[model samples]
Target: SFCPDSDLIRPHRPVNPAAASRSHQELHKELQRLSQEGKTELQRALEKRKWEQRMKASRDQEEAKKSTSPLHQELLKRHQRLENVLSSHCYCCFQFLKLRQIKQRQLLSIDI
Candidate 1:
Protein backbone atom coordinates (compact mmCIF):
# COMPACT_ATOMS: atom_id res chain seq x y z
CA SER A 1 0.00 0.00 0.00
CA PHE A 2 1.51 3.37 -1.12
CA CYS A 3 0.88 6.00 1.47
CA PRO A 4 1.05 9.76 0.81
CA ASP A 5 3.60 10.18 3.64
CA SER A 6 5.79 7.27 2.63
CA ASP A 7 8.75 8.77 4.59
CA LEU A 8 7.14 7.05 7.59
CA ILE A 9 9.17 4.01 6.51
CA ARG A 10 12.25 5.91 7.76
CA PRO A 11 10.77 5.73 11.28
CA HIS A 12 11.32 9.49 11.84
CA ARG A 13 14.47 8.87 13.95
CA PRO A 14 17.73 7.47 12.72
CA VAL A 15 19.87 5.38 15.08
CA ASN A 16 23.66 5.84 14.96
CA PRO A 17 25.17 3.09 17.06
CA ALA A 18 28.74 4.37 16.91
CA ALA A 19 27.86 7.94 17.81
CA ALA A 20 25.66 6.81 20.66
CA SER A 21 28.39 4.63 22.19
CA ARG A 22 31.01 7.33 21.73
CA SER A 23 28.89 9.93 23.46
CA HIS A 24 28.07 7.50 26.27
CA GLN A 25 31.75 6.75 26.83
CA GLU A 26 32.66 10.43 26.81
CA LEU A 27 29.97 11.29 29.34
CA HIS A 28 30.93 8.40 31.59
CA LYS A 29 34.60 9.42 31.57
CA GLU A 30 33.72 13.07 32.20
CA LEU A 31 31.55 12.16 35.18
CA GLN A 32 34.23 9.94 36.65
CA ARG A 33 36.85 12.67 36.35
CA LEU A 34 34.55 15.28 37.85
CA SER A 35 33.75 13.05 40.80
CA GLN A 36 37.44 12.65 41.62
CA GLU A 37 38.32 16.29 41.03
CA GLY A 38 35.28 17.50 42.95
CA LYS A 39 36.31 15.72 46.13
CA THR A 40 39.86 17.02 45.82
CA GLU A 41 38.66 20.59 45.28
CA LEU A 42 36.23 20.36 48.14
CA GLN A 43 38.99 19.25 50.50
CA ARG A 44 41.29 22.05 49.38
CA ALA A 45 38.57 24.68 49.61
CA LEU A 46 37.50 23.51 53.04
CA GLU A 47 41.07 23.74 54.34
CA LYS A 48 41.64 27.15 52.75
CA ARG A 49 38.47 28.55 54.26
CA LYS A 50 39.35 27.16 57.67
CA TRP A 51 42.81 28.74 57.60
CA GLU A 52 41.39 32.11 56.47
CA GLN A 53 38.82 32.11 59.23
CA ARG A 54 41.42 31.16 61.84
CA MET A 55 43.81 33.90 60.68
CA LYS A 56 41.06 36.51 60.72
CA ALA A 57 40.02 35.49 64.20
CA SER A 58 43.60 35.71 65.50
CA ARG A 59 44.28 39.10 63.87
CA ASP A 60 41.06 40.58 65.17
CA GLN A 61 41.63 39.25 68.68
CA GLU A 62 45.22 40.50 68.79
CA GLU A 63 44.39 43.97 67.41
CA ALA A 64 41.83 44.40 70.15
CA LYS A 65 44.34 42.89 72.72
CA LYS A 66 41.82 40.98 74.79
CA SER A 67 42.37 38.02 77.20
CA THR A 68 40.93 34.47 76.81
CA SER A 69 37.54 35.26 75.34
CA PRO A 70 34.21 33.46 75.13
CA LEU A 71 34.21 34.47 71.46
CA HIS A 72 37.44 32.55 71.03
CA GLN A 73 35.85 29.45 72.50
CA GLU A 74 32.91 29.76 70.17
CA LEU A 75 35.23 30.11 67.21
CA LEU A 76 36.99 26.94 68.30
CA LYS A 77 33.70 25.05 68.23
CA ARG A 78 32.87 26.42 64.80
CA HIS A 79 36.25 25.33 63.51
CA GLN A 80 35.71 21.85 64.89
CA ARG A 81 32.36 21.63 63.11
CA LEU A 82 34.00 22.63 59.83
CA GLU A 83 36.62 19.93 60.26
CA ASN A 84 33.92 17.37 61.05
CA VAL A 85 32.08 18.22 57.87
CA LEU A 86 35.28 17.85 55.85
CA SER A 87 35.91 14.48 57.45
CA SER A 88 32.39 13.30 56.65
CA HIS A 89 32.69 14.39 53.05
CA CYS A 90 35.98 12.51 52.79
CA TYR A 91 34.31 9.36 54.09
CA CYS A 92 31.45 9.63 51.61
CA CYS A 93 33.88 10.17 48.76
CA PHE A 94 35.81 7.07 49.76
CA GLN A 95 32.63 4.99 49.81
CA PHE A 96 31.55 6.32 46.44
CA LEU A 97 34.89 5.46 44.88
CA LYS A 98 34.79 1.96 46.32
CA LEU A 99 31.35 1.35 44.88
CA ARG A 100 32.34 2.75 41.52
CA GLN A 101 35.38 0.46 41.48
CA ILE A 102 33.18 -2.56 42.09
CA LYS A 103 30.87 -1.51 39.29
CA GLN A 104 33.78 -1.05 36.89
CA ARG A 105 35.09 -4.50 37.73
CA GLN A 106 31.70 -6.02 37.00
CA LEU A 107 31.58 -4.24 33.68
CA LEU A 108 35.08 -5.38 32.85
CA SER A 109 34.14 -8.96 33.57
CA ILE A 110 31.10 -8.67 31.36
CA ASP A 111 33.22 -7.28 28.53
CA ILE A 112 35.62 -10.20 28.87
Candidate 2:
Protein backbone atom coordinates (compact mmCIF):
# COMPACT_ATOMS: atom_id res chain seq x y z
CA SER A 1 0.00 0.00 0.00
CA PHE A 2 1.41 3.41 -1.04
CA CYS A 3 0.94 6.21 1.50
CA PRO A 4 -0.07 9.67 0.00
CA ASP A 5 2.49 11.39 2.23
CA SER A 6 5.21 9.25 0.67
CA ASP A 7 4.57 10.79 -2.88
CA LEU A 8 6.47 13.99 -2.22
CA ILE A 9 7.39 14.45 -5.95
CA ARG A 10 3.83 14.07 -7.37
CA PRO A 11 2.77 16.41 -10.20
CA HIS A 12 0.34 19.18 -9.17
CA ARG A 13 -3.25 18.93 -10.44
CA PRO A 14 -6.12 21.52 -10.44
CA VAL A 15 -8.47 21.02 -7.46
CA ASN A 16 -11.50 21.98 -9.63
CA PRO A 17 -11.60 20.74 -13.21
CA ALA A 18 -14.49 23.05 -14.26
CA ALA A 19 -12.70 26.19 -13.09
CA ALA A 20 -9.50 25.21 -14.94
CA SER A 21 -11.45 24.61 -18.15
CA ARG A 22 -13.12 28.01 -17.84
CA SER A 23 -9.78 29.75 -17.35
CA HIS A 24 -8.36 28.03 -20.43
CA GLN A 25 -11.37 29.16 -22.49
CA GLU A 26 -10.95 32.76 -21.36
CA LEU A 27 -7.26 32.76 -22.32
CA HIS A 28 -8.06 31.35 -25.76
CA LYS A 29 -10.74 34.02 -26.36
CA GLU A 30 -8.37 36.79 -25.38
CA LEU A 31 -5.68 35.44 -27.71
CA GLN A 32 -8.15 35.34 -30.61
CA ARG A 33 -9.28 38.93 -29.89
CA LEU A 34 -5.70 40.21 -29.93
CA SER A 35 -4.97 38.35 -33.18
CA GLN A 36 -8.07 39.87 -34.84
CA GLU A 37 -7.07 43.38 -33.69
CA GLY A 38 -3.56 42.95 -35.06
CA LYS A 39 -4.89 41.73 -38.42
CA THR A 40 -7.26 44.73 -38.68
CA GLU A 41 -4.42 47.15 -37.90
CA LEU A 42 -2.21 45.55 -40.54
CA GLN A 43 -4.97 45.76 -43.15
CA ARG A 44 -5.53 49.47 -42.39
CA ALA A 45 -1.80 50.20 -42.74
CA LEU A 46 -1.67 48.45 -46.10
CA GLU A 47 -4.69 50.38 -47.35
CA LYS A 48 -3.17 53.69 -46.28
CA ARG A 49 0.07 52.87 -48.07
CA LYS A 50 -1.80 51.98 -51.25
CA TRP A 51 -3.81 55.21 -51.15
CA GLU A 52 -0.67 57.28 -50.63
CA GLN A 53 1.02 55.60 -53.56
CA ARG A 54 -1.96 56.33 -55.80
CA MET A 55 -1.94 59.98 -54.77
CA LYS A 56 1.79 60.27 -55.45
CA ALA A 57 1.32 58.72 -58.88
CA SER A 58 -1.49 61.16 -59.67
CA ARG A 59 0.64 64.14 -58.66
CA ASP A 60 3.56 62.93 -60.74
CA GLN A 61 1.31 62.52 -63.80
CA GLU A 62 -0.02 66.05 -63.40
CA GLU A 63 3.48 67.48 -63.11
CA ALA A 64 4.54 65.64 -66.24
CA LYS A 65 1.52 66.94 -68.14
CA LYS A 66 2.24 70.51 -67.11
CA SER A 67 5.85 70.25 -68.22
CA THR A 68 5.09 68.67 -71.61
CA SER A 69 1.95 70.54 -72.66
CA PRO A 70 2.33 72.37 -76.01
CA LEU A 71 0.80 75.61 -74.69
CA HIS A 72 3.12 75.70 -71.70
CA GLN A 73 6.17 75.09 -73.94
CA GLU A 74 5.10 77.88 -76.31
CA LEU A 75 4.59 80.32 -73.44
CA LEU A 76 8.04 79.57 -72.03
CA LYS A 77 9.66 80.18 -75.44
CA ARG A 78 7.81 83.50 -75.85
CA HIS A 79 8.85 84.66 -72.39
CA GLN A 80 12.54 83.90 -73.17
CA ARG A 81 12.35 85.79 -76.47
CA LEU A 82 10.76 88.82 -74.79
CA GLU A 83 13.48 88.88 -72.13
CA ASN A 84 16.19 88.86 -74.82
CA VAL A 85 14.53 91.71 -76.73
CA LEU A 86 14.17 93.83 -73.58
CA SER A 87 17.81 93.24 -72.60
CA SER A 88 19.09 94.35 -76.03
CA HIS A 89 16.83 97.41 -76.00
CA CYS A 90 18.16 98.48 -72.59
CA TYR A 91 21.79 98.09 -73.80
CA CYS A 92 21.11 100.30 -76.84
CA CYS A 93 19.61 103.02 -74.63
CA PHE A 94 22.64 103.00 -72.33
CA GLN A 95 25.08 103.28 -75.26
CA PHE A 96 23.14 106.31 -76.70
CA LEU A 97 23.21 108.10 -73.33
CA LYS A 98 26.98 107.59 -72.97
CA LEU A 99 27.63 108.99 -76.53
CA ARG A 100 25.48 112.08 -75.78
CA GLN A 101 27.47 112.78 -72.61
CA ILE A 102 30.80 112.49 -74.51
CA LYS A 103 29.67 114.94 -77.25
CA GLN A 104 28.49 117.48 -74.66
CA ARG A 105 31.89 117.34 -72.91
CA GLN A 106 33.72 117.82 -76.24
CA LEU A 107 31.60 120.92 -77.15
CA LEU A 108 32.16 122.50 -73.73
CA SER A 109 35.95 122.07 -74.07
CA ILE A 110 35.91 123.66 -77.57
CA ASP A 111 33.95 126.68 -76.28
CA ILE A 112 36.41 127.25 -73.41
Candidate 3:
Protein backbone atom coordinates (compact mmCIF):
# COMPACT_ATOMS: atom_id res chain seq x y z
CA SER A 1 0.00 0.00 0.00
CA PHE A 2 1.28 3.54 -0.94
CA CYS A 3 1.85 6.04 1.76
CA PRO A 4 -0.28 9.21 1.70
CA ASP A 5 2.78 11.50 1.71
CA SER A 6 4.19 9.80 -1.43
CA ASP A 7 1.69 11.57 -3.83
CA LEU A 8 2.96 14.24 -6.27
CA ILE A 9 2.56 17.82 -5.07
CA ARG A 10 0.90 20.65 -7.14
CA PRO A 11 0.44 24.37 -6.43
CA HIS A 12 -2.86 26.15 -7.06
CA ARG A 13 -3.92 29.78 -6.45
CA PRO A 14 -7.51 30.99 -6.27
CA VAL A 15 -8.69 33.60 -8.76
CA ASN A 16 -9.69 37.06 -7.46
CA PRO A 17 -13.16 37.89 -8.91
CA ALA A 18 -13.04 41.54 -7.81
CA ALA A 19 -9.76 42.23 -9.59
CA ALA A 20 -11.02 40.68 -12.84
CA SER A 21 -14.25 42.70 -12.73
CA ARG A 22 -12.38 45.97 -12.20
CA SER A 23 -10.04 45.25 -15.10
CA HIS A 24 -12.97 44.54 -17.45
CA GLN A 25 -14.73 47.72 -16.40
CA GLU A 26 -11.63 49.82 -16.99
CA LEU A 27 -11.16 48.38 -20.48
CA HIS A 28 -14.77 49.16 -21.41
CA LYS A 29 -14.50 52.75 -20.25
CA GLU A 30 -11.32 53.32 -22.18
CA LEU A 31 -12.97 51.97 -25.35
CA GLN A 32 -15.91 54.33 -24.89
CA ARG A 33 -13.64 57.34 -24.38
CA LEU A 34 -11.64 56.59 -27.49
CA SER A 35 -14.81 56.15 -29.56
CA GLN A 36 -16.15 59.51 -28.40
CA GLU A 37 -12.90 61.26 -29.23
CA GLY A 38 -12.89 59.81 -32.76
CA LYS A 39 -16.46 61.03 -33.37
CA THR A 40 -15.60 64.54 -32.15
CA GLU A 41 -12.60 64.77 -34.46
CA LEU A 42 -14.66 63.63 -37.46
CA GLN A 43 -17.36 66.19 -36.67
CA ARG A 44 -14.79 68.97 -36.47
CA ALA A 45 -13.31 68.05 -39.86
CA LEU A 46 -16.77 68.05 -41.50
CA GLU A 47 -17.61 71.45 -40.05
CA LYS A 48 -14.36 72.92 -41.33
CA ARG A 49 -15.03 71.64 -44.83
CA LYS A 50 -18.52 73.15 -44.81
CA TRP A 51 -17.21 76.48 -43.57
CA GLU A 52 -14.63 76.62 -46.35
CA GLN A 53 -17.27 75.90 -48.98
CA ARG A 54 -19.48 78.69 -47.64
CA MET A 55 -16.58 81.14 -47.72
CA LYS A 56 -15.81 80.24 -51.33
CA ALA A 57 -19.45 80.72 -52.29
CA SER A 58 -19.50 84.11 -50.60
CA ARG A 59 -16.40 85.19 -52.50
CA ASP A 60 -17.87 84.05 -55.79
CA GLN A 61 -21.05 86.00 -55.13
CA GLU A 62 -19.08 89.12 -54.36
CA GLU A 63 -17.11 88.76 -57.59
CA ALA A 64 -20.28 88.31 -59.60
CA LYS A 65 -21.85 91.38 -58.01
CA LYS A 66 -18.83 93.52 -58.80
CA SER A 67 -18.64 92.39 -62.41
CA THR A 68 -22.36 93.13 -62.96
CA SER A 69 -22.27 96.61 -61.43
CA PRO A 70 -22.95 99.63 -63.70
CA LEU A 71 -19.65 101.32 -62.84
CA HIS A 72 -17.64 98.22 -63.73
CA GLN A 73 -19.51 97.83 -67.01
CA GLU A 74 -18.96 101.44 -67.92
CA LEU A 75 -15.25 101.17 -67.20
CA LEU A 76 -14.95 98.07 -69.36
CA LYS A 77 -16.70 99.83 -72.23
CA ARG A 78 -14.44 102.87 -71.91
CA HIS A 79 -11.34 100.68 -71.88
CA GLN A 80 -12.49 98.91 -75.05
CA ARG A 81 -13.13 102.21 -76.83
CA LEU A 82 -9.73 103.56 -75.83
CA GLU A 83 -8.03 100.42 -77.16
CA ASN A 84 -9.86 100.77 -80.50
CA VAL A 85 -8.84 104.41 -80.86
CA LEU A 86 -5.19 103.66 -80.07
CA SER A 87 -5.07 100.78 -82.57
CA SER A 88 -6.53 102.98 -85.33
CA HIS A 89 -4.07 105.76 -84.58
CA CYS A 90 -1.15 103.31 -84.71
CA TYR A 91 -2.36 101.96 -88.08
CA CYS A 92 -2.52 105.47 -89.57
CA CYS A 93 1.00 106.26 -88.39
CA PHE A 94 2.34 103.04 -89.92
CA GLN A 95 0.76 103.88 -93.29
CA PHE A 96 2.24 107.36 -93.27
CA LEU A 97 5.74 106.01 -92.55
CA LYS A 98 5.49 103.46 -95.35
CA LEU A 99 4.44 106.12 -97.88
CA ARG A 100 7.36 108.38 -96.87
CA GLN A 101 9.86 105.52 -97.30
CA ILE A 102 8.46 104.69 -100.78
CA LYS A 103 8.78 108.31 -101.86
CA GLN A 104 12.38 108.51 -100.63
CA ARG A 105 13.30 105.28 -102.49
CA GLN A 106 11.67 106.60 -105.71
CA LEU A 107 13.61 109.90 -105.51
CA LEU A 108 16.89 108.07 -104.93
CA SER A 109 16.28 105.78 -107.95
CA ILE A 110 15.43 108.75 -110.19
CA ASP A 111 18.64 110.59 -109.20
CA ILE A 112 20.81 107.52 -109.77
Provide the global lDDT of candidate 2 against the true structure: 0.86
Per-residue lDDT of 43-94 in model 2, one digit per residue for the tens?
7779999999999999999999767878878998999999999999999999
Candidate 3 accuracy as TM-score: 0.52
- Candidate models: Cα lDDT each: 0.85, 0.86, 0.86
Clashing pairs in 2: none
Worst 10 residues of 1 by lDDT: 4-13
TM-score of each: 0.40, 0.47, 0.52
| Best of the two (1, 3) by TM-score | 3
Evaluate model 3: give its lDDT.
0.86
Output the worst ten-in-a-row residue range by lDDT, candidate 2: 11-20
Query: Which runs of model 2 end up more than 4 angstroms from their true locations?
Result: 1-62, 65-67
Off by over 4 Å in 1: 1-67
RMSD of 3: 12.1
Residue 107, model 3: lDDT of 100
Backbone clashes in model 3, listed as residue pairs:
none
